[model samples]
Structures are given as C-alpha cells and as structure tokens.
Target: FINFPVFFSGVSMLIVVGVALDTSAQIESHLIERRYEGFLASGRLKGRYVR
Candidate 1:
C-alpha cells in the first residue's frame, strides 16, 4: 500500500504534463493560423515592457 500513493502521484503528474503540452500546441496552432507569433516566439521580444 505504501507504493500506491507514489504511483498515483506519478500518474497524475503525467496527465497534467500531457494536458499542458496539448493545450500549448493547440494555442500555438491557432496563433499560427492567424499569422501571429506563438507563445514562444523568438522575434523582437515585443511586450508590455518593450518600448
């Protein structure tokens, strides 16, 4: 029974990571379709702080 918790935690971590990756990919695809930079764009670093 001691190993059960560890196993469950590992499974949950994997699920969370998978969901995050999938969500990011979807968002990136949408952005690209709209001809916009992605969340991880490596362009001029334009943002709220960039003047």
Candidate 2:
C-alpha cells in the first residue's frame, strides 16, 4: 500500500520527532540546572516560559 514517497515521509517525520525530543531534553536539563523546580517534573518543562 505504501510507495517510495510515503516511506520517505514517514522516515522524515521520525527524524523530526527525534530532533525535537533531543532539543527539548537539553533545554529541560538546562532549566533544571538553573534550579527551576516544578510540579510536573516529567520533562514537560515548557511551563517555565509561562511564568
């Protein structure tokens, strides 16, 4: 059912997701190093920007 383009697209999406996760982890670690504690503590530290 899938063609070459479809397969390529899937791979591209996977790469994007991987990059986003890596970057988010780095940023979250940096935030934690700065002593920014939170209730979530689940690596979803995007909440810090809201404050």
Candidate 3:
C-alpha cells in the first residue's frame, strides 16, 4: 500500500542526506587546510552519525 512508497522515500532521503553530509565534511576539511572558514563558524562539521 502507501506504506511501501513511504518507506522507500524515507530510505532514499536518508541516503541523499548521508551523501550530502559526507561530501560537506570533506569540503570543510579541505577548506580548513587552506585557512578558509567552513559551513560553521567554529569549523567543526559532525558526521551524519555520532562517532
């Protein structure tokens, strides 16, 4: 039923979000190496999952 579509959409969203977050973290680290500010003023971007 509608539940299947809802579950699929939710999983898709999580995947997209995970990729975006990982990409941003890489970008932030690169920028920091060049003495540039990242997404946060503090320059600390956490991953999607807490370590």
Candidate 4:
C-alpha cells in the first residue's frame, strides 16, 4: 500500500505541472498572436492549428 503523504504529494505535483503547462501555453499563444517570439529562443512554439 502507498503511504498517504506520498500519494498526495504525487497528486499535488501533477496538478502543479498541469497548471504550469497550461499557463505557459496561454502565454506562448498570446505572444505568437502578437507577432512576438515564444518562451524558447530557438524558434516559435507550434500550436495544434498554427505553425
């Protein structure tokens, strides 16, 4: 059986990662829409419907 604290910790990490990803994507999209570079310096981030 898993320890209670360990299980909750894992779940908390997952939530944190999910929120971070979502927020970054939103920011990236906004930047791209305004004809600015993305968070990465290499190139623009590709979206599902846009380049």
Candidate 5:
C-alpha cells in the first residue's frame, strides 16, 4: 500500500509535464507566426502559418 502512493505520484507528474510541454509548443508556434507576420506584411507568410 505504501508503494501505491509513490507510483501514482510519478504517473501524475509525468502526465502533467506532458500536457505542459504540448501547451508550450502551441504557444511557441503562435509567437513564431506573429514574428513572421511582423517581418513580412505580404502574403509570403501565409504558406507557413497554420490555423
């Protein structure tokens, strides 16, 4: 029974870290798209930006 708590804690930590990494990647992509738009006003960035 003692080991169960440790196992659950490790699993929960891993899940949280995975979710955080995914969210960070999404934010990074948005920042990159904004940066690209700032540099180029024309449609040149349309092909690279998703969503």
Candidate 6:
C-alpha cells in the first residue's frame, strides 16, 4: 500500500526547491540587468555561489 503522508512530504519538498530556484533565477536576472558585476562584492553572494 502507498503511504500518502510520506509521498506528500516528498512532493512538498520538491515544490519548495522549485520555488526557490525560480526566485533565485529572477533575482539573478534582475542583478544582471542592473549592469553590476554579478555580485562579486564583499559579503555579497551570487545565484551560482549560493547554489
């Protein structure tokens, strides 16, 4: 028999990860479009770096 609670937990985690990826991508695009140095400043982290 299938464990519905466990399946739902796994799916929720995936959803969270997907949302995080999308949000980070949007942030990265905004930063790039601003004509900056891709977050190379002190204590500043880029999308790739955060990943």
lDDT against the true structure, each candidate: 0.74, 0.77, 0.74, 0.75, 0.83, 0.75
Worst 10 residues of 4 by lDDT: 36-45
On TM-score, the candidate that comes out on top is 5
lDDT of 4 by residue, 1-51 (tens): 765765578779899899999999999988786665434554755563553
lDDT of 6 by residue, 1-51 (tens): 665765578779889899999999999998786656544454475454663
> For every model shown, what is its TM-score relative to the native structure?
0.53, 0.52, 0.50, 0.52, 0.58, 0.53
Q: Model 6's lDDT to the true fold?
A: 0.75
**Candidate 2 residue runs with Cα over 4 Å from true position:** 1-8, 36-51
Provide the lDDT at 42 for model 1.
51
For model 4, the stretches where C-alpha displacement exceeds 4 angstroms are 1-8, 36-51
**Candidate 2 per-residue C-alpha lDDT over 7-28 given as tens digits, one digit per residue, 9 for 90 to 100:** 5787798898999999999999
- lDDT by residue for model 3 (1-51), tens: 455554568779889899999999999988787664444455555565555
Query: Number of the top candidate by lDDT?
Result: 5
Candidate 1 lDDT over 1-51, as tens digits, reads 455555569778889899999999999988787665444465554564664
Give the better candidate number (3 or 6) by lDDT.
6
Give the per-residue Cα lDDT of candidate 3 at 30: 88
Greater-TM-score candidate between 2 and 3: 2
Residue 34 displacement (Å), model 4 = 0.6
lDDT of 6 at 22: 100
- The residue pairs in collision within model 6 are none
For model 1, the local distance difference test gives 0.74
Better of 1 and 4 by TM-score: 1
Residue 25 CA error for candidate 3 (Å)?
A: 0.6
